[model samples]
Target: MLSERQQLILRMIVEDYVHSAEPVGSRTISKRSEVSFSPATIRNEMADLEEMGYLEQPHTSAGRIPSQKGYRFYVDHLLHPFRLTPQELFQLKKIYVDKIDAMERVVQQTAQILSSLTNYTALVLGPQVHENKLKHLQLIPLSDRTAVAIIVTDTGHVENKKVTVPEGISPDEISRFVAILNDKMRDVPLQHVKSKLYSEIMSELNRYMNQFEGVMSLLDQIVEVEQEDRVYLGGTTNILNQPEFRDVEKLRPLLDMLEKNRTVFQLLSQQDTPGIQVRIGLENDLEQLKDCSVITATYHIDGKVAGTVGVLGPTRMEYRRVIGVMQQLTELLSDLLTRLHR
Candidate 1:
């Protein structure tokens, strides 16, 4: 707990440091219109705040900067909501209004807009489709021994697999098989498609097609659930523009992690809660991100958590503005995904 004066000084120091990337001095805090205290008094309070672990002195200079503890305190106790400009809100709205029908394109464009607006690395975690229901299925024969299986999900996602046509299965037989499959398996979740096919569809096919075993085996491979989440990143090179990352050595590990999709997916997918989550400095479990901060929010499809989106920047990130952007974007993303799945 801090006195009203101490909290005021701490807030000013954090806001200044975040903007300028430089330590703040007593004169700077005292000069604010809201502060009636003298520089000497403000200095005493700053010293006390430093002793309490809220601020740190980078050198022998008379200035101080907020530590990670100070940032946590500001976010928890002193932070105020940043009202976005009308233009900002309009830019975000234009994305959905333009109507990109595909989920992948919508997600990719969202990530690009986020990074472009904030000038920070942006990540959009693509939906995990393990349980997405199949809207339709089609099998097309290209030759006597080759066929293509197309799977369409209710969420507007498509997956195609090429397989060898069964030795004795004719085109008419294939059409009949697809008709039966559509009747029995439409709307079944992807992860259960193989099981449903084996038990329910297999017996029906065995009576007419002698190659039922081979066809069923191929279907099993087509519908298997993907084990890894997909991660989309935008403005990956933006980190190099930050003052803190001018040195290549300090940026290498983070750049390497970002380049590998799985690492970024694992990092952003750590949040399970419903709203925006802020991890500052050492709070992030990953060592590569200790010098940075991450803000994550989960986006939903049909009222269920489908994926996550995040902004990654140096620990000196603009929390107020970034948090505001993340909140609005996630809400819009949720709405967009719901519409896509419908």
Candidate 2:
């Protein structure tokens, strides 16, 4: 526990360092914060804060900076929820509403808007198909040897891929196969399309003059390809602008880790607790990110978790503002998905 005066001095030091990115001396805090204390009194409080491990002096003559412990305490206790400015809210709403019709575009634009608003790197993990029922499927025949497989999910997500037809397959046969697949596969979750369903569909198709064996294989390939989830990342360049990342050697490995989505996905998905999660400093486990912090929130569809959205920034990030943004963004994303389902 700290005395009231010590707490005030700690808050002043943290706020000063966050703004200027510099160590704060007692005289500077007294002069800048307008605290009702003499320089000597403030210096005594600073010494007490240093003894309590909340502040650290970098050098003999230099001022003090908040330690990681101090930062954690400030985030958990001293911070208040930050409300978005009217201009910021208007910008975010405009971006989201303009692209609501297309799921990919909406998500992409959301990431861009978040990056722009926060001035930090933004990450969005794409929706998983486990809870998304198929809304529509269309097979467009292009030539004797190829066709386009278009799939739409319940959340209005559209996925299309060009597939090569098996040898010796005719256009008439392809159309017939497409019709059979549409009848059996529509309205079912993609993740639930199992090997048993495959066998049953194949058996039914084989009865049609043994013509759809090749078509069945193509359908199998499409289902397999669609099962994998995707992760979208934007604003990596924004990290370079932060003063904490001025050292290129320290920043390179962190940037490299961000490039690899699988590792990030694993890290974010591991946080199973409800509401927003904060992982700070060395707690992130990845050595490259030891000096950074991550703020994440899980977004859902139909009450089931579909994916995660988060911001990555230096440890000196504005926790209150970033947390507020993340909370609102996740809620807005959920509301958008719910409306889409309706």
Candidate 3:
């Protein structure tokens, strides 16, 4: 519980540091801020802030920078929502209106737009389809030993894989199997397909030669291979521009993690909450992200959360602007998804 004067001093220090990316001295704050306080008085308050863990002096001669605690306090209390300009709003609406027709395109373009708007790395995880029902399954014969398996989901996601066919199965037999499987599996939730439908398929297989057992094994492999959700990422170069990450050695692991889709998916999935979540600095579970901050907001369809959209940047990121963009983008994505369902 800081006094009013201390709070004012803290706010000035944080705002100054945010803009300049430099430690804020009492004299600098006194000169730049509207608060009419002597440098000596401001310096005394700053020393107290340092002791209280809200600020830290970077070096012997340097001024004070907001510590992680200071940033947490500022974001929780002092930061106000920043509004976008009319042009910015118009650009966002235009993009949303144009790309809402295709879910893949929407997610991809949303990530790109977020990066462009915020000048930070942006990521969007595709809608989770663990409970998605199978819409159709098709198999195209490539050779006696290999075939292409196509599985379509009710949500319009299509997955394709080249699978090994069992020995001695004719193309005609393979086609028949695909038709039978689709008949039994289409519109059935994938999560329940293994336990509920596997027995039925096995019974059908039993009516054939014992050699057909291999086909059931293939089907089990396909079902067990987890369905991968799509991910869109943009702005890899933006991290290099941030002062905290300017050193390439310090930035490599982060860049590597961003390059892999699974890591990004896991990072976003950690915030399972339904709305906006802000993870600052070491708050992120990933060690590589300890120096970064992530702002995420979930987008929903028919009141069910479908996926997440988020921005990643340095801890000194412009929170108000990024949060504003994320909020607007979340609403835009939700509206687009609703229209898709309709």
Candidate 4:
């Protein structure tokens, strides 16, 4: 248990370091009106905090920085949520007021806005494919050799791509497969669609269809579940502006992970349970993010988690403001999705 004075010192140091990206020393903290302690007394407390693992002395400098444990403790206990500023509120509200019809565009814009608002790299994970129900499937013949495959989901997302029609398959065969897919896969979540097809529809296709192998190949192409298509990122290069990331070695790996960590974002979809989630320093699964922190909030459609929106920055992040902004953005995103579907 921390004494009131220790808590006060830790809070001030965290806030100061977040703002300045520099180490915090006891003398700097003693100057605050809220801190009535002498610099020597405060230095002794800081030494104890460092010994307890709440603070770290990065160099020979007599300054201290919060350790991962310190950060976690501060977020869980000392952090207070603050309301968004007027300017921040206006920027977030502007996202919905501007017309956007496509779900992808909405998500992309959400990520962009979140990044600009927080001045940090923003990550927006679009609705998980497995969690969304199949709404409609159609195969429109462009020619005898090719057709456009369109798959619609309950979340109002549509995926369409040109697919090759095997030589032996005719338009009638295409219609039959389309009908079978819609009949069997409608209302089934995307993740289960392929399994259901193999289990229930394959035998029928093989027995009744003229070219069984060709039909199965076409089915495979049609249901190729897009696992990473939904990830939307904004301000990927924003981290370069932070002083902590000035070293190229430290910056490169994190940027690389952000550019291609689809699995990381997919796992973020599972954070459906409410409230802001804070992952500080090594708490993150990716080793690339060993020096960073991620603050995320899950947004939903019709109360089912559709995606996650998050900010990635150095562990010295402005927790109060970033968390407040994320909360508002997630809420607005949910409301926008609900209204779009309705």
Q: Which residue pairs in candidate 2 have backbone atoms (N, alpha carbon, C) closer than 3 angstroms, thus clashing?
A: none
* Estimated TM-score for each candidate: 0.88, 0.85, 0.87, 0.85
lDDT of 2 by residue, 43-150 (tens): 888887888888899876569988888888887778776788888778677767875675556666667777877888988776775556667778787887788888
Give the per-residue lDDT of model 3 (tens digit) for 1-342.
888888888888887787789888888878864778799999899999999999999876569988888888887888786777899889889988865565666777888999999999998987765556777888877877887888777767677778898787777666666677688888777667766555667677556435576766567655543423577888878888888887889999999999888888888887777878888899999999998989999998888888898899988888878888888888888888767655
Residue pairs with colliding backbones in model 4 are none
TM-score of 3: 0.87
TM-score of predicted structure 2? 0.85
- In model 1, the worst 10-residue window by lDDT is 221-230
lDDT of 1 by residue, 1-342 (tens): 999999999989989998998889998888899999899999899999999999999877779998999999998898875766889888778866796777867787788988987889999888876667887889877889888888888767787778777677778777876777678888998888778877776767787666677667656756764434357888999899899999899999999988887788788778877888999999999899999999898989889888888999998889888888888888888898788777
- How far is 35's C-alpha from truth in model 2 (Å)? 2.3
Model 4 C-alpha RMSD vs. true structure (Å) is 3.5
Q: What is the C-alpha local distance difference test score of each model?
A: 0.84, 0.77, 0.80, 0.83
Task: Looking at model 4, report the run of 10 residues with the lowest lDDT sum.
Answer: 261-270
Best of the two (1, 4) by TM-score: 1
Give the alpha carbon lDDT tens digit for every residue of 1-342 in model 4: 999889899898899998887899988999999988899999999999899999999877779999999998899999987688788678667756775765666787888888888899898887666676788998999988888899898767788988898899988887887888788789888778777878877788776689878987887777676677878888888999999999998888877787775765654664678778999989887788889999988898888777888888999898888888888888888888877655
Question: Candidate 1: where are CA atoms >4 Å away?
Answer: 136-150, 160-183, 208-214, 225-229
